[model samples]
Target chain A: MRLELKEVASGYGHRTLIRRISLVVTDGEVLCLLGPNGSGKTTLFKTILGLIRLQGGQILLDGEDISRWPRARLARVMGYIPQAHNPPFPYRVLDVVLMGRTAHLGPTAAPGREDMAVARRAINTLNISHLEDRIYTEISGGERQLVLIARALAQEPRLLIMDEATSALDFGNQLLVLSHIKRLAQMGLAIIMASHFPDHALLYASKVMLLKKGQVYSLGRPEEMVTEENLKSLYGVDVKIIRAELPGCNETRVCVPVCR
Target chain B: MAVARKQGSLTNSLATAEGNYRWREIALTALPLLVFLFSFPLGRYPISPGQLLTILAAKVFPIAPTWPATLETVVFQVRLPRMLAAMLVGAALATAGAAYQGMFKNPLVSPDILGASAGAGFGAALAIYFSLGVVGIQVSSFLFGLLAVGLTWALSSRIRHDPVLILVLAGILMGTLFSSGTSLIKYVADPYDKLPAITFWLMGSLAAIAPRDVWTALVPILVGTLPLYLLRWRLNVLSLGEEEARSLGLDTGRLRLIVILCSTLITAASVAISGMIGWVGLIIPHLARMLVGPNYRELLPAAILIGSAYLLLVDDLARVLTSVEIPLGILTSIIGAPFFLYLLLNARRGWV
Candidate 1:
């Protein structure tokens, strides 16, 4: 196991935003958090990543207490890409990816040839090598998200935490980013991403975590957790469950949210 | 086994990064050194290149004891310290400007636009209004300049989490208030002696710089500059807004505080000595950004080199134009304002 959050509770300034959230992500696992707009999904990621103070409970990484880890040490172990990464100045796409190596960089140490090579490889992995020298701000939203994922890849972390990283992408770009995430997990990374779409969670994730009202509503396999009843309860809309097979794999479709 | 594989890959990547970065550092440092060395021989008192080299060698090395008195005086007493001081102050202001722009995440930000220069002028003007002697003027100007910056900082930061717009607005408001007070002081001063002194001081000239003033200015400037070098990379990350910087393991509040403190002190210290020399801080960093991209590690040093070259080239023109020493602000404004307009019109959108 790479990351395990045990009964974790956290919030901002005396307000308890998320509570009793327990989950474990093993290597090669894609665990997606499904919730509505105010369902504390982002807060859960922040608590696990230690961006906000954890009010209660323990977060352990490889059996070490995550609370005790210094931020730089935590960064080396786990990489995070927030939903919105706005750049005030126009940095080249390659430069943005190279920033992932910052945790490894020393006080006066420079970004070297190897760092560029890794950045290049990550960009290639995301099929964004052609956009390497383009201005980050000028690129389309989908391209920026891929570049940011490449940045996360450059960190070479055991666990990746993404908060709505694919929310800005179109339908096809959304699938592309999730497939990239699936590939990273297949390569032994533990991914915990907060996403609004339950369909995507069911499509690619090995595990699904349902958060409701600052608590974990359910945590288990996506096959059992993403049922028609669970979708209706979580999203307060009736959902129809359907199963189909794609050319290469099985597909589980929950169609009630689409009806109305 | 997986940990071993990952560790091996990480090290391989790191080693490559280190190698590339080292060459860039060498190139950056070397180019600036060569340019700084060559700038010294360019002025009209133009020692023959050979004589200039000979004079430099004699001073730096003990083997050559005999040197011409006039050459020695021109190189050591007259030109050397002035040139070195110009280089140091230019580097200080431009680097500080780059740091300030990064901290604020605004390309238009400059060292003096925050009101440090206006405050320094007001402080110096107050000293003149009292008819204080030379010692009195320098001391009061230095102290009041510091005080004005302190006031601006306090006012801007009064409400924790003040927006950048609010901070900028406060600086502008404070700057206008101080400038008006200075105008009032100028109006009341005696027209004959005090008025001309104030006018010339406001216009800014390096003609009166002495070796002693250089030493006095060096202490605060260097003290403020060291922190910037240590924090250069962090400043680059800081340009991505406060929340992202914090999540990346940087103490954004502390880093911002340290940067604001250092850049403000450096600006106030330089303005205290140089008397509101404009555009070296404002324009040079923009040119550096255009040349080297927004990465502060490269941009900072580039700004230093280009800024020194700029001020020295312009100062050289100022001296050769007439027997009357032209105010540096007038010269820099004439040169920088047009170039800035050209950049605004020509640069690609979002490049800044």
Candidate 2:
């Protein structure tokens, strides 16, 4: 799967928040988006996901225009994992995952035994099969995040879009989820993720895109694009990038903010 | 491999859950039938269980007439239509309420959140003030009910902001508007006749339900319910909120419109026949949720069965508890309020 955006622009009706953003992601690649609040990271994502109308340019999948495709067709190809939030009803976890099969089912059809198998496969992939029968509302935050990811996987999508999926989890859970994301990429799923942490991008992203003032500031390999200068300019904060070598581990880069 | 082993265990647990769910469905399916059978012997005429069975079986079998013709009249004419009407109205209101609650993503929402009841009440009041006959009153009530929700939908559509919030606010505004219209009609109505008639209609009752009323309400109720039943799975996705549902490839706008249209049709038809029977729509869905969990696949059917039994039982009490027949609206409120309070206290067990 290949997703290419050519000079794409979008925003709320008649107000352009982001423009001139062009990027490409293919199978087995993870592209991480880094931006400050209101910097159009969400707008760019919404545009790509066809949640909002495109103001200009075109989005193509495998060199075919997809801007005019129906929402169900788009969803079949691109799965979305939203930030975890509570719904009003107490749906079981398996039921929650089964909702991802909506795009595949007919307008009036319910999920069948085959769809249930797909949902169960998604749960197993997330290693949360034990939580299948538990009430979704009663689960912990990290567990809920994993459930959301499993829901996306149930869509059987080739390209996955996540909106700060780990922003609310604890540090250890964040790493756990990120590692799972890396494994999914290894399985040949194309992934696009928005992140607040540069270290997360550094650790998991094969490619990184930096957005500032509603435009792409840079886009390249994570090591080349995520820098101390870029971080300072993006968030207007002083920061240091350090490579630490720990015993029984490879050298890893970490971002450290310097306090005045 | 470990994950695959766990998946096997998960399937076993799911099979157990499916078994339990089927049992609950069986119980729910039986409740209304049991209540329907048990209710025949409880009315004012005092038909014994053997007599009730004899009367019911005589229609199918070649049994000779062992009971008076009046017993047949009371059984067929009086109890049967009223009981059927009670179940129909109850099931319709509850189904509409469940759909509305899911669409609006608020468990507190009821079938009349979009002003269908208030609009129908105003129509009945106006028809009474003008001395319209029974058919005219029902027709006017049903049309005005549709009109009020239509107006709310139109008003909300004109605004481009938060769709759900705008829709709810517009519904409230329409509800207040029509309710005031009803009050204004009441103020001008003749105090001797029209005022009491209007007041009684607003308080809601099933005392005048004829056999035709049952047939009259059945068409719209089935029309509305079948679609909702077919779309039950989507309602679950919809309850996840608008953006999530949309990203999952649902056209949220279209689904919301269908839900609103169907719910309005059934609610108007119900209010047209039974007057403004309240609390059934508001509380029966919650009761059903408590019984069967919140999967709409099961929730809708459970709600229908429980609602039918609930209203049948309440109507039975209304018929025999006192010399004067209590309005169903009052009885449902009197009963529903305390039960709702209990639900609120134990909300975590059943709801989020």
Candidate 3:
């Protein structure tokens, strides 16, 4: 699957917060969107997911304009994983994942044996099948994030859109989740994730797009796009980009904030 | 492979839990029937369990009438309609409550949160003030209940920010407005006749429920409950909040409309028949949640059964506890309030 945004403009209710944005994400690719607070990253994602009306331009799914498509149809092609938050009720983990089949089932249908099997497969793929019967509200924050990702996967979509999915996790859990995301991309799922960490983009993102003031500041290969200069301008902060070589691993870039 | 093995072990435990839940569901399904049968022998009329059974069985079989003809009148004409009304109203209010709580994503929400009861109360008060008959009172009450919720929905839609919060706020505003309307009508009504009638009606009871009233409420309650039962699975998705549900391919607007329409229908029908019965809708869903987890598939049915049994038991108490029957609305509040407090203090898990 391929997603193309052509000069897309979007915002809440008549005011365009993000405009003139164009990008392409294809299968087996991880496109990381990095921006500071209020850089219109969330709004842009909402537009792509068709949560809000497209203020201008077109979004094409495999070269087909999908601005007018129904939400159920859009969901069949794309899955959205929002940041992990506790819902009011204590739904079991398996029940949460099975909810992904809503698009696949009839309006009044409950999850059947086939749907449950698909949900279990998604949970197994994330290695969280043991958490299937646990209460979603009782799980750890990082585990909850994985459960949500598994839920998105259960939708059986070609593309996954994640919004700061790992922002709430600890360092180890962050890497654990990012590795799973990278693995998913490698297995031929197109993924677009919004992140606050430039280092994450360097580690897992195939392509990086730096958004500043509702427009793309720079878009290119992560190695070229996640430079110290772009990072400084994007967040209005100075940072040192350090190259490190770990034993039995390729060289990697890490961003360290320069405190005054 | 280790993870798979761990999952296999957990599956066994989960299977046990599922078995337990199945037993609980069976118990819940049988509760209302058991309550209904037991309640038959408890009224002021001295009918023993054996006699009650024989009287009930006599309807299907040709048996010699071993008891007085008045026993059959009390059983069929009086007790039967009242018990059925109690169960029907209980189920309707509780199901509507469960649906509203899920739709609003709040544990504290009740069926009358959208002012259905308050509007119904006002309508009944106005009908009594104008000397309308019982049927007129019920019809007007049902219509006004729908009107109140419709106004809330319309008012909330005009505001674009924080849809759920706006909706709740609009509902509260409408509730207060209609409640004051009821109070105002009560003040001006004839103190000797209409005032007492309005007051008793608002207090809520099934003492006057007839065979016709039961049939009247039954149609709308069943009509309203069918959609909710069919859409029970979607209610879980809806409880995740509007944005998340919509992203998962649910048309949140349409689902919200359906839930509101159905919940309002049931709540209005209940209030129209039983007057302003409070706390049953507010508390019964919570009790059901304690028995079954919040998955609506189980929660809804659990709520319906528990609610039906609960009201029937309460009505039996009202009948036998004293010569003068206590109003059901008052009794539910008397029971529901302190139980709600206990749930608040003892709820270890979040919003069961």
For candidate 2, report its TM-score: 0.96
Whichever of 1 and 2 has more DockQ, that candidate is: 2
Residue-pair clashes per candidate, as listed? 7, 0, 0
How do the residues B1-352 of candidate 3 rate in per-residue lDDT, one tens digit apiece? 9999988987898799889978997889899999987888887887898888898899999999988999999988899999999999999999999999999999889899988888989999999999889999999999999999999999999999878889899999999999999999999999999999999999999999989999999999999999999999999999899888878999888988999999999999999999888888878888888878888988999999999999999999888889999999999999999989988787768886
Cα lDDT of model 2 by residue, B1-352, tens digit: 9999988997898799899978987889999999998887887789999998888899999999988999999888888999999999999999999999999899999999999999999899999999998888898999999999999999999998889999999999999999999999999999999999999998889888888889988999899999999999899999998889988989899999999999999999999988988888889999888888898998999899999999999999899999899998999999999998888888765462
The alpha-carbon deviation from the true structure for residue A61 of candidate 2, after best TM-score superposition, in angstroms, is 1.1
Clashing pairs in 2: none
Superposed Cα deviation of residue B206, candidate 1 (Å): 1.0
Tens digits of per-residue lDDT for model 1 on B246-324?
A: 5565666677778877877788777766677887787888887776778887788788778877777777766667767
Task: Give the interface-residue alpha carbon RMSD of model 3.
Answer: 0.7
Clashes of 1: 7
- True lDDT of residue B234, candidate 1: 73
Model 3: docking quality category: high
Over 4 Å off, model 3: B1-15
lDDT of 2 by residue, A139-244 (tens): 9999999999999999999999999999999998999999999999999999999999999888899999999989999999998888999998999999998999
Worst 10 residues of 3 chain B by lDDT: B343-352
Instruction: Give the DockQ-based CAPRI class for model 2.
Output: medium
Candidate 2 off by > 4 Å: A246-250, B1-16, B62-66, B348-352
Which consecutive 10 residues in model 2 chain A have the weakest lDDT in total? Answer: A245-254
Candidate order by DockQ, highest to lowest? 3, 2, 1
